[model samples]
Target chain A: MPPTGLEAVFLANRDKLVRFLTARGAGDAAEDLVQDLWLKVAGRMDGPIANPLAYLYRAADMLMIDRYRSRRQAELREQDWAEGQGPEAPPGTERAVAARQTAEQVAATLAGLGERTATVFRRVRVDGIAQRQVAAELGVSISTIESDLRMAAHALAALKERIG
Target chain B: MSQDRNSPMHGVDTVAIDWALRMADPARADWDAFTDWLEADPGHAERYDRAAMTLLDAEQALAAHPDVPVPIEPEPVRRRPLRWIGGAVAAALVGAIGVTAWQDRPQPYAIETAAGQTRRIPLSDGSVVTLAGLSRIELDHAEPRRAMLSRGEALFQVRHDARHPFAVQAGAVALVDLGTVFDVRLGQQTRVAVAEGAVMVDPKGAALRLDAGQAVTVEGDRLIRSTVQPDEVGGWREGRLAFDGAPLGMVAEDVSRFLAQPVTVAAAIATRPFRGTIDLEAVRHDPAVLGPLMDVKVRRVASGWTLEPRE
Candidate 1:
């Protein structure tokens, strides 16, 4: 039997969706999201929807945005603690040296990012702005905001691999 | 480096960063799906945590000396955001004195062993070293007993000295004895296995404190932690070579080392898994003994011995 249009879309882009979510910082969770997405599509879709791929991408993107929005405050609190807290030891201490190395590596990694991506990364990570807000201010769509964040994060992960 | 982009985790890193960035926002959030993502994979949360921790660390370092103004600052903040960071680091260093302690200095004394050879050397301190075959180590009798394993492996029976810690550096990784008996093997990859007591392993920026019967593999930037049987700590030194589903190629390498003869595997059998033990002393005289046991035909080539699949 010929696969339905929805099934065909799911088959073709399922791996791409996982890769997309994974690049976006889902890590292992990306697999689960894909599974969840599959379940959502299989269980709910009885009628034909126009542009299933776009709908799928939008649905996945929305799911991620919702996930991010759900725990936004606590994450912000942790970010404030990490960013605002003073270095535990005095200057030149071993802690400082370690921190300095980490800082240098992070700086070097961020320096290598694309100009726009770097700016987006800094605004979200350093300035602690919401992705939605960054998109609003920069006159870009939320999808662009997500993509930029993913690129920045992927770079940071590579940095960790280089130094960790 | 080539594998960095194509790695599966890179995709996850993006999602993790996305979530981290979103969480940092002041907007209201629903954390259930986020928790679901974290709970889905064992490494997902850990990777995210590391990225988040690194960001926090950079932030803390940048904010270290907010009061101390940097000399010769850039006029426009946007022109050089890095200058601000440099100023912060310099300000932090202003109060620091004699940071030379972290530099790597040349050690004075050295000990090395050849193929099929082992040595038990006593140090100035109470620590005793059992050097492995084809291993080299440099010794430093300073306040903290230090040794650099340049090649091969060594088993250390360190006496408890709280005032002076015993440390061994293997490549970028360092194993610090917190009063323990541990065997550290340096090769293509460094492996540290603790027999008795505990040891702390520092690989680049990450640190792991291993207890008795624990082992870790330090390969490049990755540290793989695993459990080790106490008896398996220094199995090679006991005249026994054991293989636990090890590749035939590696087995051949060990066989070569033990027999002091070149034992190369045919390309076809290189990856074949070999299990069971080879009594090195018994096989020392007849290198061909491995042929029957490994189910291979050992052919004595002009260059060395080659193990090929049996007909």
Candidate 2:
């Protein structure tokens, strides 16, 4: 079987692509995004492109834009929920009940985080402190703070999934 | 949403966390990678949303209680002011506006500052908070005189209120003011220095009383006591960062907070200690400009800027 155009592009620019993403602030997730891009190209390769390299970069760029937009909108919605002004479902509605229950579970999970981890996460998420600033305040490396936040986030995500 | 219950993308909690942190402090390079992750799989966006929502939910729940739990502090005494303030605020809003407007009232607000940006916030209670750059503070009016310092530094002038004592919670430590002017810096450790009057610092289970010219810093469960000068309180308010024999790396960190761009030090010069003041009034924000003042070489790096030993 012949290799697809995207496969060739990925083979050529995978390292460059990951480096590009990392420089942009993807942190450690750049590898995952690039791998996913490769998979996407491999799966959807109908034929060779006129400019495979340009196409891959463009595709990646578009993906990032879409993610940014959706994430911003989601943040606004989350803010609304936090302020208790989310779309009013009837008090007894399943969605409302579920949201309340999920919030409780998330709070419990957060309360259960390790002392240092919880403090770091609270400062960033609740106190709205910057991650770099938190690291400096704690006299730890920025990566350490990021990892602590990641630990809290993963715990909350697990709780969210479990509650669902 | 359809396909695999067992797929790896279905469980993207770590990736979501990474995205969250990056989004909070994104560089020019992060957005492209973020978009790639979002576009890479159907489950990725969903997981991110879930994680973000969960975090938001937890914050809201935690904020509802005026007395937030600290890692080492004993259980908080249930304060009656919470109930009283809830009713009072609700009543005041309904009386001033209508019930509908009061129902839609905003949460007790939070103010955040970018690096190099400072804000002086006057609370409803007349207490003043001078928030330094790269800092965050939340004012829950129901919690009234209390504020939470998440990161960075703040100089607080608490209006003397015996009925409702002013308190500031920074990470795992709590600072209760005894009618004083004080500065609290929330960094790797929490430092509380009283410029006038006194302060009671509760770190873990022990409470230490700090009087004027006294300061204490909490690292994990350990409390270190030290002396502070009155001039050192809110020194950043005058556009100056005074370091007393602080390491070069720590000095660089303070400078980074003052400038729009960050400056990283070479490992060799990171720990060299210096006791002096960096006058922000006279210097440009460039590390290269600062190198001469500090006896170092500042060079532009691909990442941003790096400081090295001067030849």
Candidate 3:
């Protein structure tokens, strides 16, 4: 069968996606990333996408982010092992400590923002509620919810930089 | 916040953040505009990536800290002090409310076991519940005789009391122990097998009484009754699963509980019936062994193993 919808877009822009991945520092793994992207797109049985090209790009970006996160986690694990910690230490002890610290830092940062902004962020991000639903429940406009999310994102970006 | 929005880097960062957020919801994202912005500036893509990463990290942190307080609306305050007679009436009302609240309190706690792990919990009533891997059972401290198996499998050895009988709720069906030892596996269907004594399946509904060595699979409103060997009722506890004409999908689900990785059957063969005893240890060592053992083709996927019919 001929490729259609997102699959067609993906095949047509395969080279562009590889270039995009390489530009995002995928380097040697760009081809592998593109393959992974193909698996994701091929398995999809959803309705027609509004902007197939843009969707592919965003999906590619997400794939890269996932790769980065997994790599970071592995590095963290290696660092823990290299620190000469005893092997008897329960698994995930270091992860739990790091997670607790990050959680506390996030709580403190969100506490500094407006109550509504912090609540909005928690309801949408932490609680996994939809943004539109959050706005409706909060009796605010969708634009208001967007602005609140933007503020939360800005604060979190600063926090990440500080943590790094 | 307004001052930060006015900064030189803010223009690009704000738009990038907006794009990142919009992209999260596929229905709302303007991909054409997003693509244009990315091509317009090399820096825009980088900024968007950073924003997305930051959001992801923040979400992970919040998730890890489950106790992070969510600010909910405050309760309404009472404006007037109670009069002497009114105070007595209010105190009586409070007492009634307290009793109701005590009885209607939420499920006190839940016990969950990860995949490839099992937990044996002995209740205050001398009943022992052995939960299978990848299973969750919710119990109320106030009521130890009741349990709700939300997912996975569990073996119940009840210290049956005629007055306060042990009841297990799996899906829409309720199994009340009639002085019995039974195993209930909840998945696409709820399967219950009695090793000893008897149990009433859905007293209010079908009210089917399953005696020793009797098994029933509850699917929707239908109850499929069959006989099982008394010894093999909860044989999974001994790492032995004997299926007699069981669907491939159900077999996969049962096997998946014993292995750290998931075992999934291809859609084409998902409903195919299989009759056999699978040694989980051998499959755990080499998932590919299942292909020859079950006379099917097993392909190793990134996440786990996928079973397919031999072509």
Candidate 4:
């Protein structure tokens, strides 16, 4: 059968997607990533998307993020294993200490933000509540909630940089 | 270069974060504008990726520090219009009448299984239910066509009757068999997978029809549908547990059901995604074998076993 909707769009822009992924530093895996994108689009059961092209690009971006995460996790695991075998300290102790420190830093960062921004971040991120509902509960507009989340994200980015 | 608020690059970071937040709601995202922004400059794509990664890291950090208390106000009671209140009163009166009729029906009895045990229950209507370990199911002898799985997992080979459809309720979600063999697992999320024939998930709400080699995971009000291998639906019955990017916490829960002692996962690696098949029989004898299979350190705690990240 001929492709339709998102599938059709994907087929026409397959090369463009490959270019995009390559430009985004996918390197040799650009083709494979494009294939994965095809599989995702083919398996999707949802109705027609509002912007098929943009949706495909967004999905492609997320795919890259997932790849980066798994790769980073594997590297961390290997590094930890190597470090565990060293004579400097006992195995797994450093990981626990680092985790505790990161947690403390995250808590301090949240505490340092404005009360409203911190509350909004907690309700939306920690509690998993809808931003619109949180806005309604706080007697604020959705844009206000979005702005608060942005501020929280900015603070977190700074924290991650410091931790690094 | 310094990344202070006054830096020229700070504007890019702010816009990137804003875009990331907006893109969280994919259905309503202005993707055209986002793509335009991304294509406007190569640095924009890089900044956007960092923003997205930062958000994810923040979520993980918060998850790791669950003990950190953030004061939250109690939920406010929503006030309904007078017309809606009157409608609700009438609906309650009708529900009371229905309850009176329902009270005459036979009570549903519960069937439970301990860890490392499985029970095969043959219903009166010719359907067979294979309840997994550490699971519970409620069945009514008088009405053999209905069952409720309160926890854990079960495989149902439903005998389809066009006049009397077989229905299985898992939490708020309900699955009605349409000449089907399906597996339902209840945990932090509800999962329904059809092995043979078809099933209707959430028949009263989304009413999604899933056929063979199809599955759906219901989390909150969202129903995410995906494809699954038909033969792998009840692989646990064959001493194999298959996972495809399932969180370690959920995998540990499944593994715990097959052993005399429960398997516990550390909070740090609880959300780590694992994809592989575990040999339940092998792990049952020596839980430490999970260390190699799952790339984690398995330590025998006082209670049972703990799976921690290799780190």
Q: Which stretches of candidate 1 lie over 4 Å from their true place?
A: A1-164, B1-107, B141-144
Q: What number of backbone clashes does candidate 2 have, counting pairs of residues 3 or more apart or in separate chains? A: 11
Which candidate do you rate higher for lDDT, 1 or 2? 2
- What are the runs in model 2 whose C-alpha is more than 4 Å off? A1-164, B1-106
- What are the per-residue Cα lDDT tens digits for candidate 2 across B1-311? 12323343333344565565556543312545565666666566555555555566666655554254444432222222222223443343235434444455455778999988889998877889999888999886544566878778889988866555676777666666766789988764467777655676762235566655556756554666654444566787888777655668777776666667677889999888776677765544445667776788889877567889988
Q: lDDT values of the candidates?
A: 0.63, 0.64, 0.75, 0.73
lDDT of 4 by residue, B172-245 (tens): 67767877789999887688987766687765556666665557777666676654555678888998888867
> Chain B TM-score for each model?
0.61, 0.61, 0.66, 0.67
Off by over 4 Å in 4: A1-164, B1-104
Cα TM-score per model: 0.42, 0.42, 0.44, 0.45
Query: How displaced is residue B46 in candidate 2, in Å?
Result: 72
Of the two candidates 1 and 3, the one with more favorable DockQ, higher being better, is 3
Scored by lDDT, the top model is 3
| Candidate 4 lDDT, A1-164, residue by residue in tens | 89788888998998888877865558778899899988986797487787788889878888877776776667666787788853333359776677767766766555544456677887887677888888998998887687677656666765665465
All candidates: interface RMSD: 13.4, 11.8, 17.9, 14.0
Determine which window of 10 residues in candidate 4 chain B has minimal summed lDDT. B76-85
Best by TM-score: 4
